[model samples]
Target: MIPLPAGRTAPRTAPVTAPATAPAGRPAPGSVPPQRTASGRPAPGAEPGRDLFVDVLRLLGMALVVLQHWSMPVLSFGDGRIATGNALAAGNMWLVTWVSQVMPLIFFAGGAAGAISFGRAARRGLPAPAWVAARLRRLVLPVVPLAAVWLPLPHLLLAMGLPEQPVLTAARLAGQLLWFLAVYVAVVALTPLLVRLDAAYGLRVPAAMAAGAVVVDLVRFAGGLEAAGYLNIAFVWPAIHQLGLRYATGRPRRPWLIALAGYGAAAALVAAGPYPGSMIGMPGAAVSNMAPPTLALLAVGAGQIGLALALRPCAMAFARLPAVSRVLAWTGPRMMTVYLWHMSALCVVTAMVVVGLGISTPEPGGPAWLAGWPHWLLLLVLALWPLLRAFSRFEMPRPAAPYTGGTVRIAVAAGLAAAGLLLFTAFGFVPGPAPLAGAGLLLSALLLGRTAGPARRNAVPAPGTRR
Candidate 1:
């Protein structure tokens, strides 16, 4: 979910390995070759060229997430409560998530981008603590505006005599989306260690993680230890992430074979095992493939990665067209804002159409629903545009003075930020102190990331070090 540059195009056959001129003429795992411009010089610092395939995948994954969220949700308001149901819960729609559920791809792309970016910083002598601090700032800052609005808005709405249930619903739903951020925070915080492990062990690291996931699932299912399922979070996401780390340094051989094997494994899991067919959770289902993400989800993720590799040539070609380039460039910078607020946009549209105007949603798969879908999408877009404009400024964090903080301080800052996001994920911004406390933690983390003013000026005297 990390925001990366998206404008520049690279050759469709861009090298995925370190340059041949490097010592030993063999690229080290997790090392990115320096990118060059057409004139054979390094690409500009501010706008270094990006892998077109990764950029395209990131944008497309985000777009699909938004579309799926916007299009689902069957809503109606009555008795001071807004009833909700999933349109995708309707028959046969669950199959679509195989392609549309792109969280794995997002994390994969993030890992790839992190690998390349960290490699470049390492080459330039940037410390690990400083790199992690900068990444925390980018991930946590955009969330400030979101918290500011939500933490107070619920209280204000309740004071105005609005129904408590609906207000609380919106608040919880808003914060629930932060689960991704919380997990990603942990992922990013551990990136330095993970990258090192990847460099040393290569595919063996992910292979080990996958084995752990299989063990967890077996223990979980066999013993009926539902709580034990959460342990897979440690195993599942990082395994997929390691794939991205590998892909950044080199393409896989026979990617289509991977796709075949992955899909076959997933099909077997769903058919012969307890896993559900849907990648995303559905209401009233006996089991959810998503809530604790099963082995099936990981299998499907592998399939998606392999499929993406198989289609890289065409995807990059399509991404290079002038119109597509413009859209990618424009959306890239603002993608974070769009993601954070898209649900809020859904709430606004829901309130206006369902609560204010008393318009109930049509039944899924009905003609009315089919007809109203486009207009519903248009209304959501209308609601979202202003939000995009208002909050996009926070997407690019204000550059902080070079971090003079120690590794412990950087680690603490990251911990505080992750804790805050986790708090929101667990207990949302309802009319309570949790939201305020979460916001305080985030601000504290940001402060810790800053350099000490007087101390830096007077005491920084090391040779070759800047105050």
Candidate 2:
């Protein structure tokens, strides 16, 4: 969750850039003084100085997600067509994922970013509806294009010579990642309320949510009420999401101890508290703590937060290097784009190698697959550049007007985004009504947002672009 800074006087728009360096003279309280690097460009690390670990963790989380998708599907050509199955389906190695699950940190960062962005707007007298609208709009734009392409993709594959199974597989491969997007939108929708809860109750709120998750998991596993576990989506994420509560409350305390305690608890639960070891799912495994999050996953995230905090000072120090700062600066603004399109990039490579190149499956980790991995990575990177260039404009910070829209409209827009996100996650973008419904819902959100204040384009060029 990148806390994209909003402009105070006017409605803020997309692709927030570094504010210009202010003069050396001391600035007024509650205002940021600008700074630049040796390159004379805005030193992204300096001005308003975003937390490096947040950026680091975010980038790392996104990368791991891509890697997971990139590596998970075991693809091979058979009967002159591409076929795939999950590697995790077989091995008990999923136990490693208990410690490897990083999405907790991702959601935690999302909460903090939402808190920061909304707080900035509130200070400027920006309406709450508009603030929520602005946040949702940024989150939704990337999905529009994705749906546009994917909704029709299945039908097109069927029309082609491709078989039904492979076509459906491709469509699923494209859409499976939307679960994160869906859950994220829901958590974000609840941000303002969650922040309020923190203000009133402090740590108790997250503790309560975590406790509720424990109960849900207990019933889900004990009584075979697997459906009941879905509640953990609301429960488990908020538990981790609320860790940002400390930030929103202006209470500064050392979190390393909490992090340590979390890991200890998570390990104990996995080891002896009757929970499974893996934080992720295996295709045929009896229980998956991931698909419907469980206490094990939440504990993993809590511990991860602690680990991240314990390392922040060192991360910040390393981030200070000018080269690293510049890179972070570039990646920070485009993080959303990367998250949206990275999977698409991998899919493109899979298409080329398995379907196009007619490469057979390499015996599930046999020599041929290992030999081609470098080639696979190279192809994935090659496919990504053009996709980013074409689609990133959707993410440009558009000029926004003050939201005067009533709370009802805000709820409607959020409802649309949330519902649409859930639909997409459950069923990957599909033909006919699915795309229309999801994209249409998000599109309605944008329309409602404009009523608050119409977006007005600013003269500031999108950073790093050639005029």
TM-scores of all predicted structures: 0.89, 0.86
RMSD of candidate 2 to the true fold? 5.0
> Which consecutive 10 residues in model 2 have the weakest lDDT in total?
9-18
Candidate 1 residues 1-467, lDDT tens each?
23432222222122222321335643333332344456876443212245667778888888898999998899999999999999888888988988988998988887776666555555456677777776777778889999989998988999999888888999998888787787777787787888788778889999999999999899889989988888888888888888877776677888899888888899999999799899999999877777787899999999999999999889867766656766766777787788899999998998899988989999988999999999999999999999999998887654454467889998889889988988888888887788888899999998997655533334422211123
lDDT of 2 by residue, 251-305 (tens): 2346688677887888888788457666777666677778788888888888778
The per-residue C-alpha lDDT of model 2 at residue 220 equals 91
Indicate the TM-score of model 2.
0.86
RMSD of each: 5.1, 5.0
C-alpha-based local distance difference test score of model 1: 0.77
TM-score, prediction 1: 0.89
List pairs with backbone clashes in candidate 1: none
Pick the lDDT winner.
1
Which stretches in model 1 have alpha-carbon errors above 4 Å?
A: 1-48, 452-467
